[model samples]
Every structure is written in structure tokens, then in C-alpha cells.
Target: MTADEPTILATSAGYERGKYGIFDMRPGPIHHFAAELANAGEDAKFCFLHQAVGDPENWIGATYAAFAKTNYRASHLQLFPMPNHEDIRTHLLDQDVIWVNGGSVANLCAIWRVHGLDEILYEAWQAGVVLGGVSAGSICWHVGGSTDSYGPELRAFTDGLGWLPYSNGVHYDGEEQRRPMMHKLIGDGTLPDGYATDDGAGLVYRGTRMVEAVADREGPLAYELRRAADGSVTETPLPTRVLKYQ
Candidate 1:
């Protein structure tokens, strides 16, 4: 009921696999993300709103369809193509879960703020509705914003939705070259603690409580971050890397 309440599911940004080559109709990381939504509950509905570079319509159907197969009465917030004009904040009052897909983080944040969806989701989380996104979805949750994925010149404009206290750079370990960039970004002293997740990996924030940080692939990656007090950064190996090299 209040905006200050905790979020239901705080997630990292990245891609997840789908079933049946249907891309949308099958379950993957997302299904495993939230066990609360596992059982049939009050006719729960999950919305996959898209606003990045690609056509919203192309992804809307598959993601919505994939989520719907959860054996719950899953349905899109709006059946029409993405970038829907529907009042998502208001809709959250009625739904159980919301999944904003990945794409352009800038575009997604712009649209989210334009329609005040951020405020709505914050309110919904207090009411116990699960809130999550894939790529941009997870990035928007960070406090420093998702900087690595974007171009260098765009760093000034890379401010995220400020949902979480720390910033994140996804898919870091996937590309070895990203290490230098991450080190540079976090070392610049602009970003606080930076978290890097491999392709099949994720960090879950449950209303500010980190329940788990998991990696589906070999192991997780590593994290490079600076503490706020002394501004000293610590680079910790993620689950995957910790198991591999350590």
C-alpha cells in the first residue's frame, strides 16, 4: 500500500531460455526465480512489457505465452502489442507478478518513468506482488545503473531506476575482455559495488534481502565493487568462478 515498502523480487538483468523453441511458452530461469508463484494462487497473472530496440510485438506473445504455461491462469497485462498504454501501476493492484523483458535499458527506463510504472511497481511490491525483469528489468533495479552494456560515451546518461543501492554489469564473465572495462568503471569511483553475472547466473534480492545468488552455467562469475565508507573496492569471485579456480 505504501511506496516505501520492500520489493517482492529484486533480480539481475540477463537472458533466460524458453521451452518448445517457443521462446515464450516455456519456463527457464524465471520459473525458478520465484517459488512463491509456483502453486495456483488467486488466478495470478504475469505481464511481460517490452520497450527496448526490438519490436514489442515480436517478444510480447512468446514471453507472455511462455509465462502463461506456469499452470497458473497466466495472461498478459494487455493482449495487444507491447509499449502498451495501459496503466501498469494500476494493473499491479490486481496482478501477482510482472516481468519486464530486456532490450534497451534507456528506452525501458524512459517509458517506465514516463508512465510512472516504477512508482506503481514499488507500491505493488509492498502489496506482495512479485516484480522482475530480464535484462533491462534487472539493470533498472540497480542503484548505479547498468553501465557496462551501454557504450562509453553514454555513461553520463546511464543512470538506472535507482531501485537497488548498488549498480550492476551483467554478462561480465561471458566476455573476458569485459574485466578491464568493469575494473575501469568501478575504479572510476562513480559506481559503488558492481556485480557481474554470467549468462545463466543471477542475484536475487527479496525486498532487500538477498536470498540467493545462483549460476546455471559452469559457475558464477566475479564481482568488482567499491565500499562506500573508504571507497575501497573488493573483487569477489562469483559462485561459478569460485568453484572453478578456487
Candidate 2:
């Protein structure tokens, strides 16, 4: 795979439940996404890195159950804390997809750095692995993002893997404080102008260029926020193609 062939699928929020109750996982669309990454049913290995969860094992079972419904048959859904069964570099290189789990972005970054998974992940990405995840998982790929990782208050998080040139904002509609905080950061030059996605929507990128915005639900939009010359942030809605779950 070439440098320009790298695929990235990132979502603001997934089909998981909070206090509101359970949301359908929409396995069809997710399977389709996995199939695309797997290159039309060819065998692919999926690695689920849950360092963000703090305790990686906490969500491993749920993650496995979630992806088991997907078309990608070969998956390595394990926690970061598990004893390495193989060399980390070799393990990452063998994966066709690297799915990150959401939790604390700050903590995740720090952990990955300490374990050298950051560099390993970058290598995998460069070698054409599809890097993806939700929430903090999505946020870590870009230069920065608006996050509540530190505490209850959402703030600008400017340290990311920088695989993508710009920043990002997730849960655009799901979280009330997210929109305003992202806008303020971009407008005030605290955060770089970048992309934002509502829950259920995702932005697909081929390398650093955005190829498309996709959603599993109706009315969920993705936006490109840019700081204009006048120091105001302008939000341009990117057309999103709704993925059929059937």
C-alpha cells in the first residue's frame, strides 16, 4: 500500500448506551465499514487497543461482542494490559485494522507514549492499516481536539498523534458543551481549525485529505470549522452520505 492509500474511519460516538438506555449497534453499517477495510472479504486482522479505558480489560468483552457481528472475521480484540503474545511491532504490522477504544484522551496518549505504542501505531498506519475509533479514539488521530478527558469541563487538548494534519471535535450534538467549546477554541486560536462530527456520523480520510462524511443515522452532520481572516470561526457543513444498515 502506498502512503496515500491509508484509510481512517473516525466517529464521534458509537452505538453504545449511557444513562439513556441501549442504542442499536447498527452492525450492518459497521460490518460494511469493516468489509471495506478488509478489501472485499479478504481475511483481515482487527486489533482493539483499549488503553483509553484505563483498565483495558473492562471493555474487551463488549468490544469483541460488538465486532463479532461484523463481516471482518479475523479479529484480535484484546486489552493493552495483556501480556504481549508477540512482538508489538510485528503484532501491529499484521493488523489490517486498528480500532481504538474511548475513555481518557490525555491518559491514553500518555500510556501509548510510555509503551511506545504511539510509534508502533504510526508505523501500522503508514503501512496501510485502517486506524479508527470513537470519541477519544477518534480524537487521538488528529493534532488536537475538544475533550473532557481532564475533568468535567471540556477544554482544548492540543496533543495528539498528529497523523492527521488538523484537529478534531467529537460528539458535536450529543454533548452540549462540545459545540461551544470547539467554536471558542477555534475562534480564539486556542485550537487549530478542523473537523467535527455528531454522534453516529464519521469522517473518512485517505491520508490527510477527507474523502467523505458518513453516518448511520439521519440528520447527523459533520462540519469543517475554519478560522477566517477576521478571527471568526466559520462552520461549513460537509455533505454526509447515510450508510444503509441493511
Point to the candidate with the largest TM-score. 2
TM-score of each: 0.74, 0.88
lDDT of 2 by residue, 145-239 (tens): 99888899998899998888877999999999999899898888888889999988898988789889998778899999999888888999999
Prediction 2 TM-score vs. true = 0.88
lDDT values for all models: 0.55, 0.76
After TM-score superposition, the amount by which residue 91's alpha carbon in candidate 2 deviates from its true location, in angstroms, is 1.5
Output the number of the lDDT-best candidate.
2
Question: What digit string (tens of lDDT, one per residue) describes model 1 on residues 25-94?
Answer: 4555444444343232434465556665444455667665665545544544432245344665566666
Error of 1 at 27 (Å): 1.2
Q: What are the C-alpha RMSDs, in order, of all predicted structures?
A: 5.4, 3.0
